[model samples]
Target: MTKDIHLYTASTMNGWKPVIFLEEAGVEYDLTHIDFAKKQHKHPEYLQLNPNGRIPTIVDRSNNDFVVFESGAILWYLAEKYQKFLPQKPDERSVTLQWLMFQMGGIGPMMGQAMYFQRIAAKQGEENLFATDRYVQESRRLMEVLNARLAKSRFLACGEYTIADMATYPWARAFYWAKVQVEDLQHLNRWFDEIDARKATQRALTIPKPFWAFFGKGNVEVQERENADRFKSDVISRSNI
Candidate 1:
């Protein structure tokens, strides 16, 4: 029999979302690593899989070899397919999708641009201060919006854990690298801690097959500290992008 799902991914914010969904929804799947440094995603074969040429593409082998790309789209797809994390009621579903869109359109893009400008561009001595400052602030602002929404409820949408949470969680925590002060955002911090403590989430965020920012499977604290240091320095000298 064919596999249930085949996920082509690297380890990162967007890439990790579908993995979490598959695990939380209890879907069987196999993961194939895409080498970012090798430009593996842009290869012709991978291009056939995802025309946009990105990670987190999935072929639903169990579903007639259907393919899906774009992290947000994948999250929505998994939620619908499993009818697990997404709300079923119409109003609730709309709200859930709204927050998912918040991440897809706002948080993810801003954070990515901010990191690239702050970490990669700055180190190259060709930093676009204007772009960096704008995106960092925008990313921080988006986080604060999330913090405010979370303040009103335990989760982002439907007042419960849903794909909205899955979509946003990975990118939100990277505010550390964005130079955003999240500690003051009490509700956001609380939600983050709660999700971080989930058994499934813990499993997701590991050295191997888990969620975003897997602390790896070693001295977790030491690894986190090292990452902290790198993020604080804007990753100026890092070879890996």
Candidate 2:
């Protein structure tokens, strides 16, 4: 198939969301690495594609070169265009969107803040225990909500896996990076492990290559610190969270 979808992304959680959807859908797409360190995303040309100047923007050349920004929006767009992942029924579709919104408005932001406060903030000598604790606590609470939902449902939206699962799994898998524990949340762990075991998810995670891939044989701590520093520079410096 022709690679018409152009994905400009890095190896962040949000970036992986749509890629996983694309891979699972068996869609061919080209990739452009948006280098945060080089400030490529801030260029005027890139800004035209995404006013927010964020990673994980997509240009659908097949659709009149249409552009989609925001990770959740990208997932929804792909699911709708392909008629997969998202249910056709109104009630099921609404429930899927609800969980997708939960991840967008709750899990992503809270865990992102938890990551900043727990890892990057201390490294920058601007550590605030209050902020760290607050986000971590909130993240845990959100995890519990997810766990409760997963305890009853096979997936986040319905019996079958949907875009909601695709949107949330990447963030949940990185819980440790956010300083939130999941060992106690059996349902959450079950849900996470099942998603993690998928072949498409494993493949999508390496798009543009993950941060640790550059380190190879380097010291683990050095690699982690560098990754955290990049996260701070790319995300924390730009937004309030």
Candidate 3:
């Protein structure tokens, strides 16, 4: 099987995870932007590749066009396929999976909700101060967890850079946008700086274009207008199912 892959992704944190793995693994892959604004993710053709209709699904052409969805699962799949970021020793492998799960279950959801409340709901004038503060606090607490972990170890798991770090870095880097400060989390800050300086991360952040930087800098008013209609349509469509 060849290393050829086709990635359908966007510029969101979850979307960047697998791309970071692919870049670090030095694998050949083509990318197609999953345009949320256009609702292309819900298209039947794309839905077949990922029944959940989420961004960052990958089709492994080398392995008989095997399809993988969910960002964490994609990372695991690639790691096993190439024997790259995953550890071989059983104990270290367990440690890697543990931290990967920590990001999947803890960091991603909390920070994502923080982003929604701060950047979306609040800005849309549907501000829920309680919800915003709740998520932001939880997100900061998770950062503290990572900060403390890093104080003892260089990487998140396996005593080396692993998929766990790849899975978490995108979300961690966006802590500012989530309104969850990492400035006080000195160890976490140091970890972020190291990953941010990597050449693979530099290239990974650009796959499908950088959000919160270039393409994401588009007019907020127009995006809000479009998103309102798109979300309403999505709700109606889901209700029928």
Candidate 4:
């Protein structure tokens, strides 16, 4: 089948997974920038494809025009379709899946809640102290779990670069903005630096062009404040919940 993948994504951690794997696998894909400022993802047309109305949905034109939502699923879909990143051996693949699940179930949700409370919840009040502290602590704990794993293995699973790494790298790489103590986790820093230097990873970081300048690791500080400002002013401030 001719590779016809259209990636609908915004500039977020989960949004990077599919494009990262695609770039790493050398697969061709089209990027459809989802402008959250316009609520593009929640449009009736987009909802027909992904009711979840989330960023990072994929439309696979080669596969009967199938649409895949949820970034984790998109990562698995592309990995299996291209036979890249994900391991071939059962044991290694299992380990990789375990780490992927760790990100989806543990880090993503905890960090998301922490971010919402710390950033968006300002609309509700000054700061959601309880929710922010609770989720941030949980996020830190998850980072510690990952740091411990990296202390032993160079990568998260099977000692090789796999979807597990692709799945978690963006989130882990955001340790500073996530309010994580970077010095407390030297092992993860080493691992993140290695991945950050890869050429493929470099390409993956820039999904929609003309906007890549704001997405680099070094530019994270400015981007973080900008993202929070955009979210708060554009959406959260206008929303009661």
Candidate 5:
């Protein structure tokens, strides 16, 4: 018997990672879109499920007890529990973990800050160009690392598509989706194109479209406006000036 997995996610890169993995692994799961507009992720109910108040949380309906959060942890759980899309060899497994950690620690956060400064920062015009360039350069360097790694191997680890690929693809894809130039990273571009061609990735892109539509054509603009407003309100509340 197949178990039911309940996935709570938004359409952001991190959120899409597990959705794509679940589809690619042919796992049976139900998706629930956590609307970022209304701050659904921070709601009392969701906090009970994930104290961090983040999306991409999952519940195992089979055992009616298992709960998991964080995209990396989710990938690890699905791979271990299903025993699919993960290498059995200890060394390859360790390498896979390395790339996944690289994505989480290096690429994701840097790109996130890049997006913030480019799209949402209130005093962004006054911000140091060096700071902006710093993040952009770091993101580019990480892409170079991935490109060089991919040139030697078909995937980030083990020379085969695995959870490591699933973990990194979404964030790397974000560079393109955000219209960031990556023409120089040829190998990474090739790998990105390969993942984009997958049926599962295509399907994951369309999941919960209606939920995203509420924020407009793309949630990026809407999210920026909301964040800006929130920041302004916070400034006013904190300062007696």
Candidate 6:
């Protein structure tokens, strides 16, 4: 019997994390590009799979038909199902889950805010400076915490290359691209360099598009402006703000 997994994701930081995990775990899966540019995520079909209407949802066609959304949940599901990128011992598994949750709850959201305020909010002008600084500082603090943890262990948890690393690396990559310096966080820089050299990660980063298309875009000012206006009209129009 053959296993089938269908992945629907864009090429954002969160979207790439599961791709990296799948590649690293040597899982054969079908990739479907959800056209985020065309607002395809909000369509009824995609929303059925992910009520949040987000990218990086997966359908496990191998088993009795299971659907998983949220990048962290997808990673955990794959790791547990494959029984490859996870630990066996109870304590080790606990540690791995801890770091995985840390990435999901701490680093990912903070850095997302940082990216939002730095790149997206820049279009709205410097009036959003406080928001930018707040997130940037929080992101840097989380990076430092990871740096301290990595200084003591080879990987994020259990001293092995586990899902914790996979969960955290994409956000670290985004942080690097955002030019939020982590030179002082030597341990993190080292791990970042290691992840940068992985074949799985390299493939994940460039998946769904060519290298040029992924990075060779101009400033997103126009797109951000349009999205902001649309969001305000669609979301805020129904509420008192």
Task: List, residue by residue over 123-162, the lDDT tens digit for candidate 4.
Answer: 4355767877898889888888988999999999977899
Query: RMSD to native for every prediction?
Result: 4.7, 3.2, 3.5, 2.8, 3.8, 3.4
Cα lDDT tens digits, model 3, 1-241, are 4447899999888999999998988888888998887889989999999999888899989889999999999999999999999999999999999999999999999998887656655554566889888999999999999999999999999478999999999898877677777778889989988997899977998888765432234575565455445455544454468
**Model 2 Cα lDDT, one tens digit per residue, 1-241:** 6677999998888988888998999998899998877889899999999999887899998899999999999999999888999999999999999999999999999998987776676776677899899999999999999999999999999999999999998888888678788899999989977986899878888888764322133364786687667766644554565
- lDDT scores in order: 0.79, 0.86, 0.84, 0.80, 0.77, 0.78
Better of 1 and 3 by lDDT: 3
Q: Which 10-residue window in model 4 sums to the lowest lDDT?
A: 209-218
Clashes of each: 4, 0, 0, 0, 0, 0
After superposition, which runs of candidate 6 have C-alpha atoms over 4 Å from their true positions? Answer: 1-3, 210-241
Q: Can you write out model 1's per-residue Cα lDDT over 1-241, one digit (the tens) per residue?
A: 5568899987778888888888777777888888765678989999999998888899987789999999989989888888889888999999999999999999999998887776556655656889888998898899889988987888999678999999898888767656666778899999989998877765665514432333234554454454445444444544345
**Which candidate should be chosen as best, given TM-score against the real structure?**
2
Cα displacement (Å) at residue 115, model 5? 0.9
Per-model TM against the reference: 0.86, 0.92, 0.88, 0.89, 0.85, 0.86
Off by over 4 Å in 1: 207-241
The global Cα lDDT (0 to 1) of model 4 is 0.80
Residue 173 displacement (Å), model 3: 0.9
What candidate 4 gets wrong by more than 4 Å, as runs, is: 1-3, 123-125, 209-225, 233-241
Ranking by TM-score: 2, 4, 3, 6, 1, 5
